[model samples]
Target: ETLVLTYDVIANDGDTDSNTQTVTITITGTNDGPVASGSYEHQIVDGPGADTYDDITGQLRASDPDHEVDELTWTLPDGQGQYGTLTVNPDGSYTYEVDEAAVNGLTDGDNPVDSFTVVVTDPSGASDTRTINISLSGTNDTAEVSGVDEGEVIEAGGGDPGVPTTEGTLLAVDADNPDNRFQPDSGRGSNGYGNFVVDEDGNWSYTLDNDNPEVDALNEGDTLTDTFVVRTEDGTEAQVTITIRGTNDPAVIDGDDSGTVVEAGANGPGEPVAEGTLSSGDVDNPDNVFQLEMGEGDSGYGNFVVDESGNWSYTLDNDNPEVAALNDGDTLTDTFVVRTEDGTETQVTITIRGANDPAVIGGDDTGLVVEDDAENTVGGTLTASDVDNPDNLFEPASGVSNGGYGSFVVDANGNWTYTLDNNNIAVDALYEGETLVDSFVISTADGTSRVVEITILGRDEPEVLHPVHIHRHDSGGDLWVPEVEGFDTGSSRPSGSFDRSLDFVANWLRESSEHEGVVARLWAALKPRDRLVYTSDPFTFNLQAGTFLHTDPGASLVLEATLKSGAPLPGWLYFDRETGEFSGIPPEGYEGEVHIRVVAKDSDGREAQVQFTIKVVDEQEVGMLLEETPQDDTSNEQTLRGKAGFSAQVAAEAGGNDLQAGARALVASLQALEN
Candidate 1:
């Protein structure tokens, strides 16, 4: 710096004359302080290894107008600035190097300024100071993330957990940022295998989508790795690797679960009813085997069997009611469960088909009835059973007669009835004690048939007689007896000489009775004197006249009998005179009528006599006689067939000599017949 001073000394000379002698004073120029001016600016990037701003050499200038540039000195008040260091020369040229550490320590922003003061001085000690500004422009520092990058997640066990995941913490730092917290929007990333997410605090998780086919196909003990990148807001990324471990999978089943077979060869101890094969699949265990909870299994209607190879069979139990009752075209079902060693199960079903079984007809096939019984019908119940069909029906021929002997009827319920035609010629032709079996075919709906027999026994219809009552007085007198007093009018009788004797006896009875009523009554009581008998059968009779004769109450009476012609009884005839019971068997050669007369007497000398006849005939003659007689006359009666050769001894003590002799003679006759 230079200075010039001018002083007017005329005042000091103090006089006009002194003004003529004016003083001239001159001062020499001296060096002055330099003026420091001008501003310095440079860009400083923040971070390690950043470049320094050295262009301030001419940017900060100071000059000395009164002093030489060499005499002027430029000095920095402090070499160290808040963000860098400064250096200067006498010419005011300076260099500034921004501290890398100081720039890094500066609060992060778009661009910041660091200013420091520098001074320039001359030899006179005058100085000037200027501010040096350094603009700090930050360089983006690489954001770093650090943490455990590996994670492990196990595959879902049987699909229980749908997603497998693992979590870890990631730490991030950015030297150029005031806030190091991650931004969720840019902090998460995913790859083909899984997704990864990170929070502001750098907590991260990797989740595997197990539903993916690639992941699901994994086998036990097999592993997979999923890589995902967790990034910071500045685009810095870190990898999180997730390892997926697999577990055992359940077994699967295939093939048909149902089958069918015939029951014929599949029942009892026979072969299996149905057969099937099963298949299982397990990627984790390729050699999986089937498991049976028990050695043998029951399928409700049958037995079930299965092997480790998944071969299964069902056997029907013959004793099971449902299986046994199966009919042709009928079906029965049996269900059972088959399992795998891994506890997988499938339901197996078996259907059994049926075959026809013959229907059985049971119960009484033989029936019995007597021809002479009030109802001469023979019948019995029938039973039928079928294993296949519960309801049984008789054939259409039921309720119809196949033979003339009887009509046989059957119902759907297996009940049957056989009615004998007693009046049929074939039935009537049956001899006494003979049996005729009426057989007919009975059948089931299936065309199975059996013969049913009805036994019809022939029985003789013995003659039933209505006796005639004759009242007698106590007085002793001659009494006349009707010839056939107690004979049944329903009986068949022979004609001829026997009729003549009956007429004679009727006249005698009419002479004694006298009254018209008595005559009519005697006529009704009179049986024909002739009787017909089969030569094959023996015959017997009683006089039946004592009922019509009258005698004294205290008198002893005896009966005397002979042929109507006063002939003795036939050789075949045996008589008990006291009681007048006659029994005889006619010889085959003798087939004719024999006349008989019976007389009764008492101690009072009263006597009565009646005559009757018996005729013997062969079977053919008897048939002819039956035909000649009216059906109504013979329908209700049959000829008496008696056991032959019965005799009785009598002691006679009658009042009259003739009666006593007759009694003795009758006794002798009976005794001789006995021999």
Candidate 2:
């Protein structure tokens, strides 16, 4: 069992021997940890004071070979709350918020300083630390006062003290050391000085009174002077001067030294008196003397004042009614004249108005008569006579007719009578009882004239009677029956029948009436037995569907009539039996075929006859074709041909046949026939 393994030993060492062996060895590797670099320290000084705490911020970077190390953490070994709060971020950044209470704990002195330490730790538990210093220093807290002058003074009534005075005390101080103090030096007090006080805010105050001895003693052309001194707590001072002067004013009036007086021979009851002047005198000024005062009266007395040179004048009172009424014939007695203290005179005038008497004249009545029998005669002449003048004549020499009598004439004596030619007659009636009134003037010896009216009564030949008639017809060409009729018939008549006839015609011719646009022919005719009166000649005849008759003008008559298409016919005609003349109007509704016959009598009883025929047609149908055509050149040269007849043919020819070829040929044929 004790066999030991051995190798054969070779002499030359080609072979190796086997033996038991024991060995010892060692192995080592590199270590990698966070290495902090670029770490620096900084400090922040407390504002203007001793410092007990320091606050700072800085960058800390660290690196490690091992992947497990991600960031470094910052710390303060003395703890945060003791000095202030320290904040560390994962990016290896750090901040220090120094405690204000800690900062105040430092002594209040110049160049006060404080210190602190900051530590930073890495993830590997490695840490680094640095120290920072903070310093505080004291500064000035006072202001300097300046710009104030010394030994200046201002008057008692000077303006604001803040402004520079003519004489004033200036104040100043050193502002840098926090204490404000001033003292008076060169300009302490002079003329303008009184008492001044300085406020804590560095403002100075000074007051002046009007009742001050210096101000009260200032009279016209006098001046007052004073000085003021302004000082601060620091002994700085300024000065200003004040001045006051007086002004002159005009003397005031204390009492009335002027009076007024009435002018001599210018004062009277109910009479116009000239105004008296006022007088006044100044004590020392001659030019101011004799100042005039205003007067009180109906006169314009205020204008009687003297000028600056002491000259004066008086004004009269013309407003008095009694004085205004005075004329050359009257005179004022015992009138009193007054004067002002300065002495001025005026005169009054008095007069009486004249009397007047009127003259008179008289007249008498005169008479005259006609050649006819006195008992049968209706009137005679009446004349007027003036006792003052026989040749006095009358105006309006002709007298008007009264009660249907003829006109009369007035003679130079105011006599009026009817003409002989118009006197009593047989066949021609005359006015039996008539009168005429006229006016005449009678002259007097004084060349004045008086007017009188004279009325004359007389009779002239009776008026002859004239006759009128009206009639109508129906549209059927038959006589029209009258709804109302007149009966008078005579030889002579008023010639205004046409005027009355037109009134009747207008009634039926209205746009809304049945006879609108109907053909109406007016006719006037005379019979062989009826004589034509020269004055009664017919001027115009108006036909309507009515009948009228009269012995004179203005009589209304209605005719009996019928209408066939709104036109009156012949049945409405009427004849006056005595004059043997006819007149009538057609019916309002007459139309279609119409036949009219009329017989008229003139003023001389002469009659005439007339007859007419008419056919009624529609106005719209007649002109319709004219409105619708184009009327171009080609159409204008073409003649129209159709059953519509000549009217259409003329229209087509005027249109020049511009219609279609067929229409043109037809129109040409029609035009040939028409031509």
Candidate 3:
């Protein structure tokens, strides 16, 4: 309201004095209310998707003519009608968005109220309101593809290579509208995966389009992978991945069918048999090689060799007993199966025939046997056999030569035990590689005289090397070398302690190599006593918060700890009856400290063990060091609690409180107290 007024007065005194003025009044009418404009109905999708910053304009503007400079306050309609927080700017521009929580509860086509009101009030208490008619709807959502049970496998050139066929179908729902359907986002074969496509009905199929770049590159065993997106009429999408596994061709093994060799014994009268090499090759894979199949021909004892690097050859193992017992003019065919890296196999036949008539000894004459106190048996059972008759008498020629050779015993009852003549020869003289051959006269048991030559091989003590690292140090803080008392005369000390240690190690290794067959025996004797000793501190790990690999191909493995006598297991995880390995995989959404106990016990009731920890979270996302017991069943698991045990069970199960956050808060409190 506008108004104005005026008044005048006059007076005289002694006569008196006074003044007079005119008075006027004009009133400004009561303030006019605000006016509303720019009002209209609008349609929008129901979600923010990934655009967190994008917003919807409310489009409501207002002004008051009576109080142009007075600020107007916008009052938005309340209740579920407002999707999200409505914010108004000073210039009267306001925004709104569909809240996920609100949208999640609303179904397609379900409308409660048809319109809402927006009120604008002026500073003078005058106000005006407008009706905003609203319409509710929903969008087609992404399809559910994980539940589709189907996979693709093809042998590049096999299985309808150029034809499109159904692999499986996809299923999806609009969530907001169950009747909404999903179809290919792109037309026909335009999905970038050759002709792989999804129809409106979610039928998935693919064809080998030779013109396509990826299809053109396909080989015998090359696996190819691709993905496609499908959508509903309302622009929603889902992705599917398809895999094509590749296979390789079989390997080709080529070699001569026959070979010739001179007649010779392996250790005595006959030696070196004829041999040949079989070459194998593979066409596709670069690391292709050969593998031998067992129980084929003479391969029962590995009569053939197939190296991982593709080398193939035949082996004549005279020491196999069967090969060594062959008589002159005897022949045998050894058949073996050889295969390529891809399991393609072929059978190879090899004929081994002796060209002379005679009994011969084969194989390395030298042999090894753990010392049985001061005596040991040596030599082979195949000494001699007559060609003309099955019955024959073989005995020591009434004359004794080389002493030990005649000391052996052979009887028709098969008593072919050969005892070393340690009594006749000094222990030092009966050394490794020592040769002793005694002649035996054979007479025909049936009186039939026949002549045949045979071979027999024997060996002497030989050196087999095995080395272990060691450092030398004496009680006097000095290094002891090779001549340290029992080792030498305790006089082989080096210029420096380190050098002395090096010399001692060298000497020890030399002795070890000379010990021949005794190294393993000694190591076996000393192993059990030290296995009970703890080699390191208890194994430990700090697991991160989040779900870990529980058979999910892409999920990260948080821990793979293995216990050992000394095996480095930081990079491997395996627990079986033999190894004392134990590891914990935290269930999905379960994060907390997990304490573990690993125990190892020997047959004598002696036990050794260690205790360790796994910090489920890298940092203090949790306020407390709450222990989370592993739940073997995902369906039976329970939510976390603010306190341990049963303290906060009811509050957690109430389903209204943030139990995870509450537990974190408790941890924070305890941490604060400690600090």
Please name the candidate that would achieve the greatest lDDT relative to the true structure: 1
Please give, for residues 1-675, the per-residue lDDT of candidate 1 as tens digits: 234455555543555555423455556676566887676666666653223433344545667887776777778777777766777766677777656655654444657777778787887888888887778766656566677788987766564673477888877766555334676733323446667777877787777776666676676678877776666666666777788887656678897789876665222233346788899986555544888543333457777778888888877776666676776678877788888766667888777776555567788777887775787666666666866665456764544343346677777666777877665544554557866555567776655566675677876554232112222334422223322232222221221112211111111111223321233221111222445776757767664442433312234556666665444677788889766678878887777777765555555433444445666767645333223211123243323211122222222222122221111211221111000
Error of 2 at 201 (Å): 8.0
Query: Which digits, one per residue and each the tens of the lDDT, describe model 3 over residues 284-400?
Result: 544346554333354442255555554445655544455544555675566666666566666666656543333322222233332222445543333334342242343322222
lDDT of 1 at 314: 76
lDDT of each residue in 1-675, candidate 2, tens digit only? 133344443344345755544433333434445565663544443343333444567565666654344555655554354445666555656676777645443322534444555555655566655554444443332223454333323333222232223322233433222234554234323554344444454445444444455543443456555555555553434444445453221222222222332221211332222332323332222313333444433232223433433344434333333333333243332222223222332222212221111113334432223323353223233333322233344443553321122345545543444432223121012124433332233333223334333333444423232211222224322111112211211221122222221111011111212421222222121111111111212222233212222222322322222221112334544444444344544344444444433433334332223333333333212322122121223543423211112222323221332211111112222111000
Return the TM-score for candidate 3, rounded to 2 decimals: 0.29
Worst 10 residues of 1 by lDDT: 666-675
lDDT of 2 at 132: 45
Q: Where is model 2 more than 4 Å wrong at Cα? A: 1-56, 61-71, 77-86, 96-109, 124-126, 136-138, 141-155, 158-675
| Root-mean-square deviation per candidate | 24.9, 40.7, 46.0
For model 3, the local distance difference test gives 0.40
Whichever of 1 and 2 has more TM-score, that candidate is 1
Q: Which candidate wins on TM-score? A: 1
Pairs with backbone N, CA or C atoms under 3 Å apart (clashes), candidate 1: 1-32, 1-66, 1-67, 2-66
